[model samples]
Target: MMRQFTNQQDLVHAGISYYTTCCLNLKSLYDNRIELKTMFISKEWEDNMWSKNEAGRRFYNLVVSNEFWDGVLYAINSFEPVVDVLRRMGCGRSSMGNIYGELANVKREIAFRFENKEEHYLPVWYHIDCIKDEHMKTPLHLAGYYLNPLFYYQNGNEIEKTEIFRDALLECAHKMYPDQSVQERIVHQLKLYRTASQSFGRARATLMNFDPVSWWELHGSTAKELSTMALRILRLTCGSLAYEQSWIEMVHKKKPSLVQCNKFEESTFVMVNRRIQEKAQMKDRSCTCIPSQ
Candidate 1:
């Protein structure tokens, strides 16, 4: 929703490279990948470097470098409600908390330990050779992918939230893994996620009351203001009455205890952070990764 600059090329390239290192067994190689020591291979190779699909894969470094801190805070604020929804559904806040906590860990992995270190950290594009592709010679990062899927699913428009979520997930794969194989591996896991969701059915409904406009109302000023923000919510409600009623139902059903049905599972990115452990094998280098004219 909010954008800052226009350094897309660096983003795609960095994203692909990051994912390649994470998804593959090339941890050894990543340990040496310094920074903009290498160049992107091809434009077409960008797709698979980020995720199983394209949700947040298109961002560039120019935007990030100029407004990185603002973007991070904004993303965290937006994700707050999504996590709240999940919490109402019985999944604890601790679950989401643990995930963000790791962002500091990743940041520490790269630069020195700042006062408040982060886990969801990334450097610039480097070492094209370490990548095994659908994302060769591309530049992008995983932070966008991570937040995109979270937003798309929690409060996106009329499309299959899964599709949007999948795109973001794939981009994350490219940014966090070592090869396309990691993306491939996640495709199968996605099916499992679908099956588990389906299996829950009404039980799942109890956990999440379908509300399109509630997020709008809380995050937006008024229904009229929200309409100005995104029509997708209007479409999601199929009108406005449906969304309001759904919100009421969800609030009414908010339970403090776990109503577990087969467990809300997430495979791939949550664990197995070994991808980050194996960064690009290069010398400690410094460059904005934003390509100069």
Candidate 2:
């Protein structure tokens, strides 16, 4: 409602002032964007290789748009300028501009500063509150507590993110720590102290947002090319499927000592073929692999 003022120049002036305040920290949105753009360009992030800074520039424009500046101008003329400026944004309680700035601000805060172990993990703990599913959340919790990069292990370059995931999960288990012998046993064997120790010095744990569980593990493996062993053993975990000894079975039975995933992705073709065969036979379109001319 505050945008109707003809003399909104004062609001713009005041807004310019507020944005410049940057928490008394050494960052301003304008300055940070420029620096980050330089960094991204130097690293040649995939997004940047394709018109990178243009998007960031547009965001800067939004924050400093004339309409926005005018609203800010008008706001300064009033006693409660913050309220008026918010109204002009017309976003009710949810301003995209606010979110954009907040995310940018946070990214700047934790971007490269993981030097202090406890301090580094403080931000991630806030993010973990956002997770809701246990079947998956369990792995994530383990990884966070493990605090090590979920990507690297003692394994060779042939490593997959799963082993890292297992280690994190093992670490998380110790942290939550049910009093049961089973929980204690798993934690003891996983070497939690050692893993968390390594993570303190490396940047890997921070990179994956400290979670080893990824969407790749979420969807059952797609069959393409993998070892014959993978083809024989990949098992899909039905989300609704619940069991008592499930973890034990998965870890001891289906888990190939050296293989790296839920295994179903590597070996799901036979099941798909069987279903296709059944459906085709139901119709006259039964299976046929005739070469096309």
Instruction: Work out the TM-score per prediction.
Output: 0.19, 0.19
The deviation in Å at residue 73 for candidate 2 is 15
Worst 10 residues of 2 by lDDT: 284-293
Candidate 1: tens digits of C-alpha lDDT, residues 96-183: 2122323323333333422333332222112111321232222221222222223334333432443543464455555555567655
Model 2 root-mean-square deviation: 23.1
Native-to-model Cα distance after best TM-score fit, residue 46 in candidate 1, in Å: 74
Collision count for each candidate, in order = 56, 13
Reference-based lDDT, each prediction: 0.30, 0.33
- Tens digits of per-residue lDDT, candidate 2, 228-248, equal 111121221121112123433
lDDT of 1 at 189: 48
Off by over 4 Å in 1: 1-165, 192-203, 206-293
